[model samples]
Target chain A: MIEITEVKQYPFIEGKNLTLCAPNKDNLNLYASWDNHPDARKYARNVFPTTAGDLKKYLERGQERAPREIGFEIWHKADCKPIGFIGFNFVNWADRMGNIGLNIGDPSYWKKDLGMEATYLILEYAFNELNLFKITADMYEMNTPSWKICEKVGMKRELTYMKQAYVKGNYVDTYQYCLFKEDWEKQRQKFEFK
Target chain B: MSEEKEEKKELVCIPFIEGENVALAPTNIDHIQLYAKWNNDPRARHYARNMIPHTTEDLKKWFEPRGGLTEHVGFEIWHKKDKVPIGTCGFGRINWIDRNANIYMNIGEPEYWNKNLGTEASHLLIDYGFKELNFFKIYAGVFEPNIRSWSVAEKDGFILEGIEEKAIYVDGKYVGARRYRLFKEDWLNRKAKK
Candidate 1:
């Protein structure tokens, strides 16, 4: 339901000491390699390696899906390299809600608060640009670092299921977290990007 | 004897108990006013079974054995900013056989509703249930009219298990009750992906 052609490039979002921007064609290789990272794959729905050609095809398909799903590779404006990917997928226009999934592909970017900054950038896109009312996300319970990012961005944990998913021949529990547009608006008012 | 002591020390170091920013301690008679406020809320009354007006005796009866096997353990949700109690959250109808439990939460002060306090408190309680109490699943039975609560549950990762037909009698009318649940394993899986 999203008008993909209408999707404009998101300018840099200034944080306390960082800026998040949309990745360009030049960084596609970096984005693909980040996606293929085993550590990043651990929490991702897709586990297979992503080739540059695959990345191009994927983005082409994304454009066809239009406003319903959008992907953006996150980059620090200062460095200009892709650090992660953040996006809204399975957007339901009728309900004004969407499933949000993101990953900080580069381990070097971990724990530096870049994830939080990227999250805020995407949230702005979801609520301000896309007019979404609710955004939901799921994470493995043991992935404390990612959950910490969720927490920092004000996503609230709503439920936890035990051993509900079988991954890599082992069962694990999943946690669902969400943030409402209103809540984000309120938080944005008080949030210091720094 | 020395070997046994070493085993005990190792177990203690395992960090079986998980703590959260929101602490849910056992309630006392001193919390009577807080309980009364929650019980009087129209929305709370709409979901709760009709009972006699809350009295001092009722408070004592409720406070007694909150930590007991059969009774509900109530906790006053406190503000992390000032440590001032503002709401209530806890578990009831603990089913050991099914390894499940019922959860309820209320921010008596309307101002705090949707302010992330409930979500934070709920997350803390959920971690307690999954990590400390070892509950396999956590569930909530909510009135159909409470869309906000439903959103909260959905955000927390609770899946809609079922809807009971006219399961609750509130304000002289029969109301439908929607059940939401989160399994421990599923929660872990979702968390791991994040």
Candidate 2:
């Protein structure tokens, strides 16, 4: 077993209830356990079982990142635990645009508005710190929590692709949501970030 | 279209997958003015989501090469007989992991409207996507009133999948947007028969 207290803490973006920190590589087993759960894995498109070795490889690949894709663990301030994760993917620094993927692994933490908090925290980091112009999100049609979180974060429905992804032995539509820096500036207040 | 620029365009040595009347040419950054004209034209932009005027700098950033899953690429539709650039057609936002992409195209000059250039360009793009890119499915979005767009998609063997109501704010009011898809199996079948 990996040492928990020995794991280095990299606190980066902090929100009212959630803190976005660097992904802890030492906790690959913990992350894999969450990912292997069917409820959470469904939205993430994990048809195959995810092992800790796979996660270790993923962390190794992410370690060579040029800020193109950044992953973060969502630390709940009240619980003082990493209940979920969020990240930027396929980021084009020149274009100042990217797509984001996020998940709250613990089902017990569902519908708590912590995902919304994490989103605002990440948006601030993406638009203001990274100087990105836009951030997009994609979710299968049946994953209401994901697209709903996108809507709650003031993201506009960019496109609805018909039968774009296969999930649970069925073809499903995919929903794309986009939030521009300018639009975020205007709608940021709605998120009620304090 | 200046005399010097026209001469340059004529002498330009951008190779293409040549067709009978139209060739899919590279989108050279030097011809930003040509692309900007198409992007800014109300007739063309009417059906597109591009609301802002495009500049050379934006085009340069857009032409930057991107790899992996979420890349956007466009091809210039070069009219061989007229020896002029007619339009642009190519993949918009691509989900490479899912093996699907959005096929977007437009004929720049209004004069080329009824010449079947759009249909020809669509066919070329669809073929390139299925054969070259190995995409499993390709799709296009058409506004509610744009029957011409839907017809072109049909001619290229696309089927209407679904429609999103009030999906777009076109001229004044919100409008429904139609979605169309062409599967690789169907495309390959057509090619084999031909």
Candidate 3:
């Protein structure tokens, strides 16, 4: 729970509805709350309790791998508060490829198409600014919202692994979606129209 | 006197993986000077793409414990017959959550070049990634001009995944990089056939 008075933003990629900002260390408490919140924790697979200490270490590790990994805090412009996270989990510079990850931890913000807009913004940054040739995202089969956002952002289902993850007492399938720069360029028009 | 001094220097290699030609040992901090030399070697650094000088202090940071699951795991390549270190190789840019890692190798000793040690080392490292680390995919990137490394990847059952045109700046000009990948299932099938 970041104190509302202490909420500060550092916009790295601005979107129509949201801004992908540099991850704020001060928001660790809020991140931990999301990890424990029932609505947000299930899809994120935070079965185990997460403490602010854990998130602080994660943020530090993310910074240590800055060259190969980039992370962002998704900020809601109207609310002036953090809503989610989106960034490349890892980038292969030699191959110009990266794996993206996104989580709208605030359930109140779900179903608003904020995720899709954030995806489009990150895709544009990944291809144009990062000069990445390919971007990939993966999710559990149960995580429909996440994959749907990936699909809407021009990623195509590339691979499916049967029973890849155990969730809620049963194994579930996992899917990988990929978008090449050339393919995304063709599909960018549709997002631009939005 | 030089030979006596060299003999007096303690060998601190702990073999982590053994092969027919060479053994992979946990990178020794005492060998930081050796690692630094390899990074600055003319022939090795050409393919290694180390334009800036790397001091022993810079190399020592790599050997320090970073307190959690490490994204990069480097190993010293030791010649079995000669009982001396020849080069370095291992996994880097590991995506543990996705179970994928990038495999890289550099035979620092120019005298050790032309031998099939790279091929042997790649096989051992890839096996470690797939079997021990439970990695789903292993990747290798080779510069367009480094045909030897390309052949090594080809011989190690890695498939040509893609090529990034002019992706890396090397030797004062840009060059393409060939991305190679091997899946754990495919590797297991090959092992079964063998």
lDDT, candidate 2, A1-194, per-residue tens? 12256545578887888888888887787788778887888789776798999988878874544567788988877767788789987786544677898888888899988888888888888888888777888899988988888888888886777779867667688887888788889878776765
Worst lDDT run of 10 residues, candidate 2 chain B, spans B6-15
**Residue range with the least summed lDDT across 10 consecutive positions in model 1 chain B:** B10-19
lDDT of candidate 3 over A28-72, digit per residue (tens): 988888778888888776767999899898888744533787888
What is the lDDT, from 0 to 100, of the residue B133 in candidate 3?
95
Error of 3 at A158 (Å): 8.7
lDDT of candidate 3 over B1-194, digit per residue (tens): 99757743766668889799899998887777778889998888998868679999888778666987889988999998887788999899887766678899999999998899888888898889988999978878899999999999888788876665556667666677787878899898988898
Per-prediction DockQ comes to: 0.02, 0.13, 0.10
* TM-score, every prediction: 0.48, 0.63, 0.70
Error of 1 at A180 (Å): 1.4
**What tens-digit string does per-residue lDDT give for candidate 2 at B139-192?**
888988888888999888898876754555667665777889999999889878
Question: For every candidate, how close is chain A to the native chain A in TM-score?
Answer: 0.83, 0.91, 0.92
Badly placed stretches (over 4 Å) of model 2 are A1-42, A45-78, A85-102, A107-138, A141-163, A166-194, B1-13, B67-70, B190-194
Q: Please identify model 1 stretches exceeding 4 Å from their true place.
A: A1-20, A62-66, B1-194
**lDDT preference between candidates 1 and 2, better one:** 2
